[model samples]
Target: MDSEKPREIRIGNAERTTALEALGEHYTIGRLDNAEYSERVDAVTAARTRSELSELFIDLPEPTPFGPGDGSAALTPAARAASAPARIPDRREKVVRTLNLFAGGGTVLVFLLLLALGVPMAWLVFILLPMAYGAIRIWAGPGDVDASGIDSAEQQRRRDVESRRRKELGY
Candidate 1:
């Protein structure tokens, strides 16, 4: 036996469970017989120290740790997207949004005003025209407004799928 002393730091339930799972894997692969597996499982359940847990894996390779080694990684993929400050819409997108608001609200205002003045209902189409454009602009999103919208990962994925489909169709 090696003379080096194992660390005896106290272990938690999660640590014990991890050790037991490792033992189960070894047994599943025939590294441990049924009797040996049962015995080790019992020992693992009773273990209280890191040294005890470490002893169970003395003959096995260490498993990889999950997540970042340091705790300071980006909070989300969106946050990691860019280090640049918040994106501001260009003049084109601003104009489009302004026009959109004006179209929708202006249509409603004019419609109410015309209705109050008792204008014929046939003239309502003039008010509805801008409102229809506003609805279309909203449905198409800012991408259509400025042609500068960033494609999301999901959008890229869908495009790739469509491209593959087109290739398969020989188009």
Candidate 2:
């Protein structure tokens, strides 16, 4: 207590406000009752030093700096840091998925419409969208292609087994 006395000297409004906030948080989480919360808040406002402010939180669990709730309690500190940025969806990814869906559906429709209209450049129009989509996929690299229950490796293995069986049956 004697050594802690020096650490509790003349604090400012900011320190008082911070301690008051901590007291409010303690009250909210049921750590401190209504009367205790009010008393601690008054003490915090009157507190003149760091140690004086520290006493309010002495029996309370440490407040999470990341957020208000216990949702992040299970996460590691690094995960908590990473999760803030991870929640935001990437704009580039959104554009890619939208483009893929539109281009795939648009290609066949455009080709058929052009052909039906008897356009001279129908054949050229027919290949353009598909070619553009292929180029985009190649440039962007593969994405979430496995929407079906089966993955590429499993499909390839089934195909190989079927081919071997057909060959053995002389088909």
Candidate 3:
């Protein structure tokens, strides 16, 4: 009856996707180099059985997609939050986004108004100014200063100082 032989379980798309994500995370963290990562990725895509997928992570550490009792599931919400790095919002990006929205909306409104007034098509060229300004701002990338001319570094420094003071005062 071949009772000693273990059943071969087949894997599906969901398992493949989870394995791929785990592999990607490992690659991102430098656990796998470009060539090794590419080879493993191709192997993962071709893997059809659970045993085949398990072979890919044999050299890696924990956090395998096929395994149960991974450490991440044991972390408390507060511990997880504390473990994550804090992100400081960039005011320059926000300002540029606002500028883009204003430019687009202004261009559409002006075009509609000019159309309603039966103005010549040549006047439509004026709408290009706001769009051009928006394009320039985007092309410039997130600069050091925001629309208010405030230096982002200075703002961040001031915020750090304030936070330190508050902590020192036990506030």
Per lDDT, the best of the predicted structures is 3
Per-prediction tally of clashes: 0, 2, 0
Worst 10 residues of 3 by lDDT: 162-171
Write model 2 residue lDDT over 1-171, tens digit each, in one string.
477544435777665555555554444434555477557766666677665666555445446222334233455666544432223334445667777787866777887898898988877865787778768767776543343323367545545543453344333
**Candidate with the greatest TM-score versus the true structure:** 3
Q: Provide C-alpha RMSD values for all models, in order.
A: 17.6, 22.3, 16.4
Candidates in order, TM-scores: namely: 0.32, 0.33, 0.40
Per-residue lDDT of model 3, residues 109-137, tens digit only: 77778788888894654667676776778
Q: Name every residue pair that clashes in candidate 1.
A: none
What lDDT is reached at residue 84 by model 3? 37
Candidate 1: tens digits of C-alpha lDDT, residues 1-171 = 666965457877666556655554444434455587667666676778765655655444322011232221423545433422235676656667777777767777777788888888936657577767767667656552212233355334444543453344333
lDDT of each: 0.54, 0.55, 0.65
Point out where model 2 deviates above 4 Å: 1-8, 64-171
